[model samples]
Target: MNLSHPHSSGTIVRCRRLLEPALREVVSGLHPWGARMVAFAMGWAGLDGREQDADGGKGLRPAITMLSAEAVGGTAEDALPAAVAVELVHAFSLAHDDIIDRDELRRHRATLWKAYGVGPALLTGDALLALAVSRLAARPEAMPYLSAALIELVQGQTADMAFENRPWSGPDVVTIEEYAEMAAGKTGGLLGAAAATGVALGGAPELADRMWTMGRDLGVAFQIVDDVLGIWGDPRLTGKPVHNDLRRDKKTLPVLAALASGGPAARELAAVLATGAADEESVRRAAHLVEEAGGREKARALADRYLDSALGVLDECLPEATELRDVCHSLVDRVS
Candidate 1:
């Protein structure tokens, strides 16, 4: 888990090239205003309903789909529909997540709720979710996996919101294992389904089942890395402010791990968060306390453990899965 591993832009660039057109086509099929709003959420259109040249997301879920297909000896073209569907699912989740989290920005731009109002943003998210299912309806095999993933995603989101309010209004502190499970559902479920559907549609059912485990592990690892970045990542690279998670008092992995430690630093962290209103200086101190309490190392080790497990699954299933391995490694090492 060398955090210093060089970041590479190549894999994401290739993924966008393969996926962008298909994504655009799906959004274009929506009702005109709905299409504009969804496109705005996707960084494709401005608040004024005009197309923009801004960069969108990393397209990581679809990349996982295509790479998983390729790893099982299928062409990316064979998995294009599944890739597009999963990418749409990911984008839909983000649109709603921003509203739920009250986040004001994404990809260095204003969040949809901030720019266009919550009603339009919520409707836009719903539109994308419907489009995701409709896009894959022609291939009924993809539906079961997609449906199950959506259920898990919603459960995860519900748990996340519940965790936030439990302290002031309810009982019990969030545990580390519970946080990991939430991450698994919110993040891993979709990636697993993406891999499963891609390989199954590409003519390999057995391989698809095994790849689901690999993808799930990769997705959990990816979320842990995201948690790290939320605390320590540079704004220039992450498009987020420093100590963003700490500022919000979000129950991310490192924070939970630190709280679970029960050390002096953890006690300090608990005191700061008990107020539920952290100022900038308190957020910075919380970051140091989380690290000094060994939360950072614990989170990194867990991420590495999951990543290694994913690699092992890939090895057993597809020994020649170099491309998939590279993509996973790049995600593990990403600066943003």
Candidate 2:
């Protein structure tokens, strides 16, 4: 289940080999300054505009696009546009997300907004989105899904931001159902677009809807795992300060679930959270209480269920897509 499973790694390598040239070609069209900023955001270069080895991201979204295409018996080239589009959108989201969250780090480096000014970083995110739209401008079969995903992504982000003001325990508190809906929109939408566009461009437009649903389900699972990591994952591996999400008062799944447990640990965790886990001691205590209240275990179980649902769609729709299935499974299984 490790993300480094040979099959998954090989698939990623093959997909990236086909993806890089196309991505660069599109990015090259940007103004020099814009391109340089993008290079930094993509881990292709440093803030000084010199190329450097940095962790951009896992390129999971694009990998899914290409694999989904191949799964449907189409060539990787058929999915290239969609792959590039999804990756660009992924970068765009990150640039904006860092600003929204006021996060200073990403991929073990300064975030786009941190390295550059917020205004420039925001514009860079907009530029990325523009490029993403341009990639599909000529393809009506796939454009709508990407557009829909953009809308959903915005809605989900708004909901997440709104959750910050709600009390930790009350009728107005964010629920698991609400969290899943937000996750589906915020994280799932673009993933859904990737799969939908992949299948649509790959020659099986009829299967796009099912694949979109599958990706959304997968997204929920992926988001839940991310919530776990945001609280408990190693800063070295995650490339950000641990417990940053909690300090920001983000309504992550683990915290929400822990509070719902109604146990002594959950109560203590809730009290600590209500005080605003701004200090290191409180954040650490809250993390431990979340785990002690069974939040971590419950989150994992829920993630498994959603992943299973996604896999089931793949099973019924594209039974021959073993590589795609493995890659999707590895996403939720990733440790960092």
| Best-fitting candidate, scored by TM-score | 2
Tell me the spans in candidate 1 whose CA falls farther than 4 Å from its real position.
1-8, 167-171
Which tens-of-lDDT digit does each residue in 38-124 have in candidate 1? 888777888888879765777777877887777778888888888888988998898999999888878888888898899998998
**What's model 1's overall lDDT?**
0.80
Against the hidden true structure, what lDDT does model 2 obtain? 0.91
Give the number of the best model, judged by lDDT: 2
List runs of model 2 lying over 4 Å from the truth. 1-6
TM-score, every prediction:
0.93, 0.98
63-121 per-residue lDDT for model 2 (tens digits) = 89988888888877999999999999999999999999898988789999999999999
